[model samples]
Target: MSLYTFAKNLVAVILFPVFRIKIIGKENIPKEGPVIICSNHTSNFDPPVVGITSPRDIYFMAKGELFEKRFLGKLLLKIHAFPVKRGMKDRNALRRGLEILEEGYTLGLFPEGTRSKTGELGRPLAGAGFFALRSKATIVPCAIIGPYQPGKRLKVVYGKPMDMEKLRNSKASAQEAADAIMEEIKFLKENHSP
Candidate 1:
């Protein structure tokens, strides 16, 4: 099995029961082709949960701090994650993300740029929208609902792909496209039921 698959399964075995993760609307994910998964960030577990539930392998851009350790950095790289210097524009990270999509792979992003401490959706950075427009990849907006208490339910809802062509045709700014994606995530979070 691939490192990504092995790591994902291991994480699922360890964390899924603890969190009681419930995934909804997974059928919305396309079986193939380039795709961008954008979602709100709250807890540290958000990325792993999304990765575990997603049917496709997702390449993620994680903060540079996580890779400060030599061993962990190597492991993360082996499992399809790269580090981005947060609070500054990192051209290399952005270029790598586009390359992943150009290769018809899935890329995951949290466009808020950082986690929201209050559990509320925040404004998104333009990177998500930029990726969609530049790579012509399908954008899937996801909402992760969680208090993250052990044994409490944590849910991930995947919305349908955003209309990228419409956004492109209308000449939407990168920030505008990101805003549209977040609005969908907010809708999913508010309307999702147990």
Candidate 2:
């Protein structure tokens, strides 16, 4: 197995005992093809939580700053993460994500751009929606809750894959599509079974 697959499975194995993860709607994810997994950013643990929960291999858009650490950067790259400049529309990073999608790989993204210190979903960025519309990839809305507390159950709910027909035609604005996706994520989180 590749380093990415090994690391992902390793992380999952490590978390399984410490965190009681109650996952819902896992079948919503596609069995094959390129997909965009979009979720809220609440903590550093969010990435690993989402990564471990999903059965498929997911390539993440890690912050460019993380790549500055040589050893950590190489490790991140090996685990299917590519660095992206934060707070701006980085075209090169976007192109790379699209290329991964074109190759039929799953891409994980946070539409909020950064972690929410306030524990609330921040303003959704347009990048995820833009890529979803451009690539015509299925968008999977995911909600993660209660991560970073090893004793508590960390919950993740994956909503049904959104076809985004209105979005596919470019008739809907990117911001509009993003808003819709974020709303769905919010819905799943609030309604998730305890």
Candidate 3:
């Protein structure tokens, strides 16, 4: 097995039970395809949590800052995470994201761009929609409810993939598309139980 999967599984085995992670709508994930896993960013743990709970291997677009650290950067890179420059267009990151999808790999991104210090949903950036529409990849909305307090029960609900074909055809702004995705996550938080 790949190092990332091995590490992810090991971590899940240890943490999933301790946290009592509740995963819902897992069957909604596609068996195989290029897709974007979109969710609100509440904590750094969100990435590994999603990685473990997902039915398939998923790569992530982490902030560029993480990659600047020597040891941490190597670790993250080994685990399938590449860096993206926040608050500005990072062409290199965008190209990498497109390349990942083109290779039919699942790409994970937080629409909010950065983690919410207060654990509240923040205004989403349009990066997720940009990548999704540009690649025409299915957008799977995920809701990670509650702060990532260790050993506390937390829920992750994956909503069915949104209709990207329709979204692609419509003349919607990037923000509008992002808003739609956020709406899906919010709906899951309110309606779905994990």
Candidate 4:
């Protein structure tokens, strides 16, 4: 296994039982090749929550501020997380994401940009759609539900790959594509609510 995969798996194994994570639709994840695993933002724990449950290495975009703590930042980098400045368009982060996709690796992106403290689905930013269009990669819509409480199962449902043909052909705005993806995620969230 790759070093990042090993580290992620190691951490996942340790936390799985502790968090009582119960993941569904894991098979929906493409076994290989470049793909974007788009998910909803809930709590600060969402990244690790989804990461630990994934069977493959899924690199995530963490905020640059998290990397400010030299020691913590180094550790995060080792585990396959690169920094992205929240709000402003960070070209460096976008470049790194593209590079990861070009290398045939999976990337995890939260369309909402930041965690939603309200637990409701929020507006999605266009970055995920932009990345998909730029890389010509498949977009896997995912919904994460339930509280990440100890002994309480945390659920994640992976939707089928989104149809990009419409977005590819028409003059549909990036935000429109993102909203459509978010709508699918919302449907999954409602259908799979615990």
Once fitted onto the true fold, the runs of candidate 4 whose alpha carbons sit more than 4 angstroms away are 1-3
Q: Which candidate leads the pack in TM-score?
A: 1
Off by over 4 Å in 1: none
lDDT of 2: 0.87
Summing lDDT over every window of 10 consecutive residues in candidate 2, give the lowest-scoring window: 166-175
TM-score of 1: 0.96
- lDDT tens string, model 3, 1-194? 98997998898998798778999888888988898899877877889899999988898988899889899999998999999887789999999999999999899988988888887678889888788778867789999886567778888899998997777788677888888898898898788544
How high is the lDDT of residue 192 in model 1?
A: 91
Model 2: clashing residue pairs?
Answer: none
Give the TM-score of each candidate: 0.96, 0.94, 0.93, 0.93
Model 4 Cα lDDT, one tens digit per residue, 131-180: 87778677888898888688877788888888888877886777888888
The list of candidate 2 runs beyond 4 A from truth reads: none
What are the per-residue Cα lDDT tens digits for candidate 2 across 1-194? 89977877898888877888888889999989999999988888788888888988899999999999999999999988999998778998999999999999899989998899987888899888788777868899999877567778888889999879967676887888888889988888788745
**Which structure is stronger by lDDT: 1 or 3?**
1
Candidate 1 residue pairs in clash (backbone atoms < 3 Å) = none
Q: lDDT at 25 for candidate 4?
A: 87
